[model samples]
Target: MLCEREKYDKISEESNRKTGDDMKIIVSGAKGQLGYDVIKRLEALGIQAVGVDLPELDITDADAVGAFVSREKPDGFIHCAAYTAVDAAETEKELCSSVNEKGTLNVARACQKNACKLIYISTDYVFSGEGEEEFETDSPKAPCNHYGASKLAGEIAASENCDKCFIVRISWVFGVNGKNFVRTMLRLSETKDELTVVCDQVGSPTYTEDLAVLLCDMIKTEKYGVYHATNEGLCTWAEFAAEIMRLAGRKTKIIPVASSEYKTVAVRPLNSRMSKKSLDENGFSRLPAWQDALERYLGILNEC
Candidate 1:
């Protein structure tokens, strides 16, 4: 397995050489888990990246988006802003739609007006919870929940509105800058002697830090289309929790349960397996295994 330093070096060398110096990129939702890491990665490569979120840049406002893009005049725009609260989205349908659908349209329009390439971050929820086969980039979307439906709308908007757009879908994302499963598990471990996680919900756990590197690399090329990006292995939520406990050297027993055991406002996909064929075919490097990513993430958590 390549160490984090080696991975960074490889990506930096390849992307910087391809993109060259002084390439300005605009990143929306800069404070998001993926966006934070992307900005850091770009900075490491000596690239000029401008990150915006909330009050500074309301993606839902078309005029605000157009003004920002016109002022920045960036070469590429990474649209990471989205209403990501899965369960909350069920009750807040309008808010979710406004951000994920209309907000994305606004960003796409801005990108088109500025002649900027767009890299939109998407999710695995777009697929229906069916079959064991990996969902390809072109797989038909059947959203199981409000969050998924809204994201699918965003994907469509980005594709239709922008001439140069790369819609990259990720699954089970965990990062330092946002609330995620990993952090929740660790927090729960502190108070609870045991925990129950869903075993039927299976997907790849993507580390935002690893994903950020891939996004930075993808923006340098013109391979505009849909792509599925996640760590190379698959596991259920139960298995993921077990690994996290094992790495942290915690003795908290992890109890496995079916999706029916836990009730939520929104439904989750049972199978979120996605194929990375597009990444390989397009000559982009795939992320490391989930285990490796977990270990590295744990090390970072320890430091914090």
Candidate 2:
């Protein structure tokens, strides 16, 4: 599958249909939060997208990645796998680096060799907690936590390796398929009378479904390069929890807290909101605000 980039570019340029049998896409980290949603959307689009996750494919194994891509020979590769345990990274730095950093290098090398257009899922953790403005695509990375550093490293590796790559950086993602902040709040609201959430940290809360739809569109359009894909608008964790409670029709009391109030091994950026300039400039539209996405997600959760 490691063909010349020029060859694949020529072939891709000839293909105009975005969501049809004309494209062969592979989604790595298929079991994770974002990966699961990506696969679902791909199916809905009538695209023959295959998923490779744990037990099926371990990205850290370079030989495994190469063999899988070689056998599949997919036209596009969406990498959602990463070491995402933020606090755990304090002790598992080696593991995080191996997966998020070195593992990304391995995948990029394979994609570069195969000439597959790579779409990598990154995080807002790359920025320092210094600004209140939304982070631009060109912002310098200054990760404050081990998890962030590891993910940033992965982004760098992938960008340097492949010319036709999409680095989608998102923040505070929630979905029906995985462990997330919203689910945590919902669960805690059930057990606790009142919750004290950090109000100082600000960022957008993204719904995986919205992101999935955007990803599908991007792949179809062959829109490559770094982009910030998340639900529009921003709020603090406390406000986000309040919105979740309101949407779920729950009466869980939410109390505000500062970053210092809740100490963790990793320091979260005070400002994690990202600019959607790149997405707009690339001909893709911004996702709906967080509240709208949450209502839809809650509606689905209720159905499930």
Candidate 3:
């Protein structure tokens, strides 16, 4: 369910008490799904979160970013902005590079200039998905798609520029305020009788709200390292879609498809699942299972 602003604040406050500090956080791409969750979570914790997106601030503009960071001087900056259209990115390489690479560079540089901690959100696409085991934090990044390559470039820029930076890689993120697999299925189910989702790609379907909480927790802990964030369990696209339909009480048949059959502009990893061992080793709490989170989401959708 979409949490009301006040309710979200209360939860954030609880999270802040655990973290022990209500920090001033700057969130770029505040209009996007992940950014929206971040902003709401920050407000809940009684933290001051300055949201900058589009007209107010574009990460691509170096001067504007520097000026804003200078003025806000936030305790931490959560760089959530990115060029996220995976298929489209294959053709719009330059545009993708401009935002995902150069734009990230601008944000990272600004944060360094302000001496603020940075939490740069990245994707699991950095891995080539050759093995069955989950990808480690330090695994060599070998992107198979342009989108992943651009994000990896951003990660490189951020790591080089910021001293206290946490490059978090998450997979299959879905949320209330953005376009995602769940939303697409729900929308399509209303018209079509069945849906074909690729089952070969295995990974966690992370809920943005849960991820927002984790991000706040990580920032408060002062853990300056790379980490993976996703729900506790994993599943393929077909399995995930089936669960979504079942929860929503929709009788849409989900047909399983192979990666090759569902041909797109960009190539996807067969196994984008990431290991949460880093977070576990670091002593943070584990998020609820993906199935549990999906049930909660369905409850919210039913209310609407």
In candidate 1, residue 244 scores what lDDT? 98
Off by over 4 Å in 2: 1-21
**Candidate 2 lDDT, 55-119, residue by residue in tens:** 87888999998888888888888899888999999999999999998888888888888888898
lDDT to native, each model:
0.92, 0.85, 0.87
Scored against the true structure, residue 16 in model 3 reaches a CA lDDT of: 63
TM-score of each: 0.97, 0.93, 0.94
Error of 2 at 217 (Å): 1.2
Tell me each candidate's RMSD, in Å, in order: 1.3, 7.0, 3.3
Which is the leading candidate under lDDT? 1
Writing each residue's lDDT as its tens digit, candidate 1 over 176-228 gives 89999999999999988999999999899999999888888888888999999
* Candidate 1's TM-score: 0.97
Give the clashing residue pairs of candidate 3, or none.
Answer: 1-300, 9-44, 12-44, 12-45, 13-44, 13-45
RMSD of candidate 1 to the truth, in angstroms, is 1.3
Q: Which ten residues in a row have the lowest lDDT in candidate 1?
A: 4-13
